[model samples]
Target: MSTTLILLILCSVMLSSIAQIVLKTGMSNPGVLNAVQSGVAMQMITTISTNLYVIGGLTLYFASAAVWLLVLARVDVSFAYPFVGLGFVVTMLLAFFINGEVLSTAKVIGTLCIALGVAIMAQG
Candidate 1:
């Protein structure tokens, strides 16, 4: 893959990972949690739709998808999709640092495995 294509794939993955973190942060808010617990679908929708963080997260998702479409146009799915695994690693680290989530040995091992898989895929 060319440098530009690699960057594009990485950008898509990073945007998607960041979007997951932002969505998690938005949903973790007490108000959003309460809305979820309320058992009212409309209430939950209203709460999430009005949340700036949620909106931002959704926007990021759109941006990521746009970039991913470009990547799909330029590369084989087999070659391009493995990069999405990197998003798991990025999300794990973001959750650990940004949300104070714990990183167990198992998770670390799994993340390493994912990184290795992506690297192997890239080399193919």
Candidate 2:
């Protein structure tokens, strides 16, 4: 693959990772959603208006989509899909800092596996 293609894949992966973190942050706040008994229409409006996290998530999602489109223009889907795994590593790392989430030994092992897989795929 060309350098440009690799860079584009990496950019898309980073943007996707950032978007996941932003969305998680937005959802972590209280008052994000009410019980379903709150009436569907009222709940829908409140869900849209009050939930900043959903808004932020959608924005990041769209941004990621744009980056993915650009990446697809330059590389095959098989090559690009492996890079999405980077988002998992990024999200796990972000969770530690943002939400005080702990990484278990298994998770660390899994993440290492993912990194190795991506590295091998990139070499192909």
Q: Candidate 2: where are CA atoms >4 Å away?
A: 33-41
Can you write out model 2's per-residue Cα lDDT over 51-86, one digit (the tens) per residue?
777687777788888988998887789978988988
Score each candidate by Cα lDDT: 0.97, 0.79
Candidate 1 lDDT tens digits, 9-91: 99999999999999999999999999999989999999989998999999999999999999999999999999999999999
Count of clashing residue pairs in every prediction: 0, 0
Error of 2 at 29 (Å): 2.0
lDDT for model 1, please: 0.97
Each candidate's TM vs. the true structure?
A: 0.97, 0.85
Every model: Cα RMSD to truth:
0.7, 2.2
